[model samples]
Target: MGLKSSQIKQLERLYRRKIAPKSVISSQLVKDLCTAAFELGRIVGLLVNRRGSVENVILGDATRLYLPDIGRIRASSQRLRGLRLIVAKPKKKQRLKAKSNMVFRPSLYEIDHDFIVDLEKLRLDLVLQIQAHVEAESKKASLAIIADKGTKVEYFRDVNNISFDFSQFIAELEAKITSQIKKAHKIALIKGERGAAILIGVYLKTQKAWKYSLNELKELCVAAKVTVVDTEVQRRLKLDAKTVVGQGKLEDICLSALHKGAQTIIFDCDLSPSQLNSITDLTDLKVLDRTMLILDIFAKRAVSRAGKLQVELAQLKYSLPRLAKKQTGLSRLTGGIGGQGPGETKLEVDRRRAKDKVAKIEGEIETLKRQRRLRSSKRHEKKIPTIAIVGYTNAGKSTLLNALTNSKVLAKNELFATLDPTARRLRFPKEHEVILTDTVGFIRDLPKGLINAFRATLEELKDADLLLHVVDATDQQYVKHSKIVEDLLGDLKLLEQKRVIALNKCDLVDSEIAHKKAKMLGGTCISAKSRSGFKDLMAMCSQALWPKDIFR
Candidate 1:
């Protein structure tokens, strides 16, 4: 890494040299750059803007060079970065073969894959590599530019022979990229949705699990009304410590997202604070994990005051520890009820204020919980059995309640469609009346903050006499879905409670298969949408609630 004063001065002088706007590089400039690299025994690189003025003079070891932080490409813009990179690499005489005419092949100077990564990731105007030789007559260079899907590279036998107008070449390349992006995003524009995202999943588990997780992420994105422009999945032995997905895959994802006009990156797995920080730093894009996306959906779906308070509490608790100095994501949560305090630094102030808000919200939620407890006592006094319907999200629990009571409770075929619990009184065929309650749906790996914040609402489940587990009959992953609900119930210590599994959506599958599935799981088959199995479902519920009583 040692540099002589003469070498340092020569490299510094490069920053003062101006290139011709119409040509890639002048013959004299190329000769001087090659001479500097040959003397320093290292690679010399330059960052040149479209005006043909040198912006930076970079020094690197033989193989790799690191660029300074140039800000991100604006997501709204569909053009190149308007800057190009030129590098001079000195080669040993043994690595270069001597031809009959004493000239080496231009392929020796072909662009490296690392440079290709830079070309796509930075959206550079172009990248040029010169194979610096002691004999100036034998120097060769290669040029690369952005193509439709990847990069296009060309080689020149002589670095000094390039005569094309660099400015005009860059203009046409940007126009092509802009036109393709417009065509690709036309449908999203027509739909008038603003947030466009790319979904990322890194899995070491079974492929089925991976696919299911990614599909669930997609549904979450849909529930949030984000336009999914693309999805990238990596099958790895284990998650990368820093990026979750490896750095290479993440770079490819950024390039794809950049080309597809996506402004956000949504991961299928929950991210630790360090992973989130590392990922956001690498791409400079809005980064969100499964938990953040779920919390956001809860924020949007919450209607009741209690529900809203619970959602805000969950968001704050999840965001407090993750508040970094450079954090730009999760602004909605960090901003809090009152805006930033005057004269207080951001990171420390956000954590302090969020803790205060969490305490206030917790107190409010506890008050609501006490009120709910009083109501539960009244039901207990009347000797009315309570049945709480719980299942994986979008498993038709709300629809089943609507079908049984003929009351609408905002039933939609989306995840977490019913955030606030709804209760209705329904009479069995035997005229035995019971209070049926619908609670928030469950999912695998539910965020811990969500579980703690919604504990008040879920407390009612502990008092219920029977747990009606609704299973989506049509899903190929129904067994796994049932297991997830059971696992959650076990975590809540409600598994010991009497339970009745009703396989909902039976009409969407074959009747024989549905019946077999119900029999296998020791449950009843029913269609919440059609109400076809209402009688059997009621019989099962009545038998579970009043086993000693005889029913007609």
Candidate 2:
């Protein structure tokens, strides 16, 4: 006789108590089983007694088992005795047949002895069987419930409940499944110290210089106090505009980031608003690009009011375009009193506020610029020539300034360590006096917003009598770095100013290489920490900033 719904429920309860605990049965498996049973219109279950014997095989459909090959074997003597084998039958007319041309039968000998079925394997086999049958009949995949281990039984109860709302159940099931997947792939918070981040980059196979850029990005992250736990790189002929890296490559990165418990992802190149949003959506981590990292370091190091204003302006300008709209389903729309105007998204409100703040800060900065121009005029009136030290970030510009003037400035091995301009009185040989000013360091691909915001500080360079371009002698890309700084100075229209090169950190490189670099850069090599070549550097500076007549 066909098993009724109540009997099938009893079988499920028995399976949960016996087979599920002994095997790797999950809620998904249970849901798949129920779905397959419902679609086939009949489920077959094997009821095995406690003594490991086949008892009774029950089918949801009342079809009789036909085993012509193994005429009814004696149930008492068969090895399958006391064990139940259940198979769901389709409500339609098609019959079930194994590959061996054997029609399914409830008889024990009809089952293959070669197959040693466990709960997990049995569940998979049943699912495959039902899927094949349904696909052949309907030509479409079946929708199955997915639940957690703790909630599978409750879900089944809800499905069977007289007042069950199938739509509500499906909605809750989908949400639960999504939440479970996200939880499985969720990034863990770093335990102590700074949060860990994954650094990712894309490069061309022919571009051997990509490592240098990635290294610079790592240094920038360090400056911002982020721990780079791992780095991923993909060599592609062309970059993917949507995600920066190829979809597969990005998936690998996301998996690695999850494994490493990283909370952020840092890209070597600046990402566009869409690209940034896409990557963030895929990875579910805080995404930062090179420009943002540099801006963050500047924000942290900015001390003076003018310096803070400039950093804030740059940050706002950079972030204004990257704001993403909130999902409507996740947000409430309000048009009542004290609410944002009608039809305006929270993202729009944020962007508007940022724009207003940018405008206000720009006005304040303009006032500061006038005050700075007046101060420069006063310095010029005193006939005190100024020497502005400039170079690629962390090239030891501030260190050189401190070494030459014997004054303390926050000199670190990090990039963009100094944001505020500091000028010290430097007396050269023969009583030649000049003001040596250390301006903010330059970097490759410096954001345009930062340059515009710091125009007042960079104005010191335009008024300088001579430029002391500090170069890190130990840097492998020192030549490239020198060119970048020169190009930027040219852009600032300070290329016409007289300049002297101070190749600092000479002690970190070979003497031969240092000499060659100094000759190539047309600068004097000096170890700022050791003060090895200061006398020559000072002599060169005095000669460039002050004429022989001034010395006399």
1-552 per-residue lDDT for model 1 (tens digits) = 588898889998888888888888877678788999888778899999978889999898877878777777453457778788988988765655465777665455677787788888888888889987866686788889888766788888888777888888878877888898887777768877557899988888998888888998999987887889888888888789999988888888888877777789999988989888888878867899999999999999999999999999999999987887563443433344666543345765767889999999999999999999999999999998999999999999999999999998899989999999999998876567899999999998899899999999998999999999999998888898899889988878888999999999999999999999999999999999999998888878888889886454
Write out the backbone clash pairs for model 1.
none
lDDT of each: 0.86, 0.67
Give the best candidate by lDDT: 1
RMSD of 2: 14.2
Backbone clash count for every predicted candidate, in the order shown: 0, 16
**How many Å off is the CA of 296 in candidate 1?**
1.6
Superposed model 2: Cα runs more than 4 Å off: 1-23, 26-193, 205-207, 325-343, 549-552
TM-score of each: 0.88, 0.68
